[model samples]
Target chain A: AQSVAQPEDQVNVAEGNPLTVKCTYSVSGNPYLFWYVQYPNRGLQFLLKYITGDNLVKGSYGFEAEFNKSQTSFHLKKPSALVSDSALYFCAVTPGTYKYIFGTGTRLKVLA
Target chain B: DAGVTQSPTHLIKTRGQHVTLRCSPISGHKSVSWYQQVLGQGPQFIFQYYEKEERGRGNFPDRFSARQFPNYSSELNVNALLLGDSALYLCASSASRQAFSYEQYFGPGTRLTVT
Candidate 1:
C-alpha cells in the first residue's frame, strides 16, 4: 500500500552540472521519505530523509531533497554532479513503522 | 565508531539448502533490520528486531527467520532456499528510542548466489 516510485530507470548528466533524481511516494498519514545510494557490490549508504520539518532537507555529500506534499514527491537534487556520484539511487517510505518500502531504483551516470 | 557489519561477503549455495547470514549492529544501536536486495531492484524489508524482540516482518515466507541477541547482533536464517532466494542480504541498524523516525545505517551486505 505504502510505496515509493522512481520513474526513471537511468539518468545521465555531465560532470559539474546539476542533477536531479525524481522520487514520488504514495502513503497514508505522513510520509517519511528517504534517499539512499548504493555502489557496486556494496551496501546502501544513506543520503538524506524528509520527516516532518522543512520541505527542503539537506544531507551528506552535498546532497539535498525537496519534499512536495501536494505532488507527493521527494526529489533528490545536487548542485553539481561528479563522476563519483554515479550510482544506484533508491527512494523509500515508511509508515511510521519499522518496515520500509523502497522503489525499484534509478541509476545515475555522471559523464565527463 | 564502526558501522554495521555482515559476515561472508559472498556465498554460493544450492537450491533446497539452508543458509545463515550474520550481522553486527553499530555500537549503541538497539534495533536491527534485514533486507533482501535483488539485482537492479531496491532493498525489500525482511525483518526488524528491537531490543532482541521481533518488531516487524516483511512479505517473506516462513522459511525466513531471524533473531537478535543481547549484544544487539543478529542472524537471518533461510531454509529450503530457492533460486529466487538468491539476493544481496543487507543488515541495518538504528537507535529507535532516540528519535521519532530513525535513519538506518547499512552493512556491506552478503551476496548469495543459488544454483
Candidate 2:
C-alpha cells in the first residue's frame, strides 16, 4: 500500500520570500514522487517529478523538490514566492503501480 | 496540442438517476483514468483504462462503471446517484499504462451535483 501525508493544512508566505510546502510518503518499493498545483476552478498542473535521478529535482515556475529516501519525504521549495504561486499543492507517490496516492493537499497563500 | 478534455463542465441530477461523463485523452496517448474528488478532499482514483481495456479500479461500488472507446476516449457512468456521489469528476491521461511513473495530464473536471 502507498500513502502520502501533508501535515500542514495551509502555508502562508510573503511575496519575494522563500517558501516551502512539506510532504512525506510511505510505500513498499522505491517511490516515484510528483508535485502538482491546482488553481481555483482549474485542473491540476504538474510541477515536478522524482524518478531515479538527483535528490533535488527542479520544475516549472521556479519550483523544486528534495526527495529524501531515509526520511520518506519529498518537500517542495521555491527561492522566491510570487502572488501567482498561491494555490493548492498536492504531493503524490506511485509505487510502480497504476494508482497514484496523493496527499491531502496544502493551500499556499502568498501575500503581496 | 490541447491537453486532456472532459465534457459537460457541470451537471445536476436527482437520486436514482444515472449520469455519464466523458473524457478525451491527449493525442497519441493510450491511457486514460478517472477520479472523483469530494469537497475538501483530494481526488480518489476510480478507474484506469489502457488499450481499451480496464487496467485498474478503485474501491467503488458496482453503481460506478466505465469504458474506453477505440479512439482512447473514455466515459464514466454512475447509476443510482446519491447525495454522497456528488463530486468533481476528473479525467487524466498518460502515454501508456506501463509508464506509471510518468506524470498525468488532467482535464478541467466536471462538477456533478446530486440533488
Q: Who wins the DockQ comparison?
A: 2
Q: Which stretches of candidate 2 lie over 4 Å from their true place?
A: none
Best by lDDT: 2
Alpha-carbon error at A112 in model 2, in Å?
0.4
**DockQ (Cα-based) for each candidate:** 0.69, 0.76
* Deviation from native of the Cα of residue A1 in model 2, angstroms: 4.4
**CAPRI tier for the interface of model 2:** medium
User: CA lDDT, every prediction?
Assistant: 0.93, 0.94
Question: TM for chain B in all models?
Answer: 0.96, 0.98
Report the poorest 10 consecutive residues by lDDT, candidate 2 chain B: B94-103
Candidate 1 residue spans exceeding 4 A from truth = B97-100
Candidate 1 structure quality by residue, lDDT tens digits, A78-109: 99999999999999998787788999999999
In terms of docking quality, model 1 is medium
